[model samples]
Target: MAVRPPQQDGDEPDTLEFGIAALSPHLSKSDLTFPATTDEVVRELGDPAIPYDANGNTVRLSEALGAVRATQFDTQRELLDALHPVLEEYRESGGGILSQLRALLPF
Candidate 1:
């Protein structure tokens, strides 16, 4: 999905987009769903790639979040909630040219 930053002074803002990995359709049903915990995600995804800090030391997910004063949620609803702000930002960015053109139509 793509999201443009808020417009300013009638000028368009830069567009930002994120990628999400989808499971292959050919995969068996057993590999399609995730377990009900973050720990399971770690096991399934095989240990998230650790990022390095300014000091060149690897940082864990919690440590990275802590550095930015942020935290992660594990529950489904909570996970969606955590993503809400970003969704809102994209919503506010308005649809692209197609949407604007559609608005100009009387039908």
Candidate 2:
């Protein structure tokens, strides 16, 4: 099943959304404490799929966090910074001929 984002009370998205900024909403929850490990973040957020590529294909939060260098993040800013490069790299890995071929396939 595709992952669905939570509905916001307002139409405007949070301004903290800059890099893996798609994740800002998930990370901003009061229930989720900071100084979290990647695993902790994944667990808290329920491993939702994040849009990763230029083509808008998504990978699970856990899957994308796999490539992040920092295992622990003291704050949301630290986590977002660590994830920025990883997400950027993932974005570059898509929208190729193979992806196009996959779109044509029945599965």
Candidate 3:
């Protein structure tokens, strides 16, 4: 993912990367079908890599889904909302200062 920070004066933001890892079988949120069961999503995604921090620590998509209580996602936004906290915790667990600092910045 290419994360772009908010720009000064409403200008376009600049994209920054910290040695990010690519998701295997790479698919974006838009590519997913909504109201998907956890098993359904996992089977389609096949445990793609999900980077948690700047250092490239990762958790598979299936593992992330397992960390959550929701068994079905009704929308792409719902999936992201449910996973955000889990992802954040994973990031901060190994993140130290950098990830914490990154959390304060705009996306």
- What's the number of clashes in each of the models? 0, 0, 0
Q: Write the per-residue lDDT of candidate 1 for residues 1-107, one digit (tens) a residue.
A: 34555567656536533311111111122332432344443344443323121111222323222332224444534533443443333334443365456658998
Candidates ranked by TM-score: 2, 3, 1
Q: Which candidate gets the maximum TM-score versus the true structure?
A: 2
Q: Estimate each model's TM-score.
A: 0.26, 0.70, 0.62
Compose the digit string of candidate 3's lDDT tens values, residues 1-107. 44665556666546533212234225464356878988887787776768766455567788888988999999766777787778778765764566567758897
Over the stretch 1-107, how does candidate 2's per-residue lDDT look in tens digits?
Answer: 12334557777333322237667767776367889998899989999877764345666788778888789999888887887787776667663476667879999
Between the candidate structures 1 and 3, which one is better when assessed by TM-score? 3
Choose 1 or 3, whichever is better by lDDT: 3
Q: For each candidate, what is the lDDT?
A: 0.35, 0.70, 0.67
Which candidate comes out best when scored by lDDT? 2
Candidate 3 Cα errors over 4 Å, as ranges: 1-25, 29-31, 95-107
Judge candidate 1 at residue 87 and give its lDDT: 34
Provide the global lDDT of candidate 1 against the true structure.
0.35
Candidate 3, residue 45: Cα displacement in angstroms equals 1.4
